[model samples]
Target: MRKNSIKNTRVNVEVQHELANLIREGIKDPRIHPMTSVTAVEVAPDLKTCRAYISVMGNEEAKNNTIVGLKSAEGYIRRQLAKNINLRNTPEIRFILDESIEYGVAMSKLIDEVTGKEEVQEDGENNQ
Candidate 1:
């Protein structure tokens, strides 16, 4: 099968959606923060494994704890997916902490700071 075949793409989207809902409404792990979200999922071409990218909105400790919780619940999650999804074999899922959101937020804040400084400099120059 092609790397980006239509079947693989559909599977990826469906798995991502189901997993997001499961995390949002079904999980009861305390280590998982309330702001955790399934940002993306990449399913293998062979459909044997899935890499779930999760974004946790919290400090480093909270993120680590959330990963731990997810890892521990991987089996249960897979079984739940098997029951909910129509896939032949529910792929083994691995949770990865995605920090892109945090990085983007940091970049935005930095940009804002730079712009504020530039505005201050412009005002000072105009008043001179």
Candidate 2:
């Protein structure tokens, strides 16, 4: 088992993919929003702990609600995965709010603002 990169780690990748699919298709929790996505799942090589980073496409309150929903269903999720996946022990599941989406959205907005300002200035100079 080479702990090189995410691609090489089959256990981690497979488990994450299976779990994400399970949550997306199987679980029916009302608190979970429709646009929730599993951004990434990181599991220890020993299959001890699994951290699932999720992103909700909405405001802060919506994100918080989604996290709460996931936390409530964590046990059920783990149990289901254990029954489904062939493993000696199912890794513990921890749901975490992924901030990369938020960061990227903010960065893009900043870039757009700067570019818009530049365009306006260029047009003004041309007209003068």
Assess each prediction's global lDDT (C-alpha) against the native. 0.91, 0.84
Put down candidate 2 lDDT per residue, 8-52, tens digits, no spaces. Answer: 377677877887787688789888888888888888766788888
Report model 1's TM-score to 2 decimal places.
Answer: 0.93
Best by lDDT: 1
Error of 2 at 61 (Å): 2.3
Per-candidate TM-score against the hidden true structure: 0.93, 0.86
What does each candidate score in C-alpha RMSD?
Answer: 1.7, 2.5
lDDT value for model 1: 0.91
| Candidate 1 residue spans exceeding 4 A from truth | 1-3
TM-score, cand. 2: 0.86
Report the C-alpha lDDT of model 1 over 14-103, residue by residue, as the tens digit: 999999888888889998888989998999988899999999998899999999998998888898899999987789998999999899
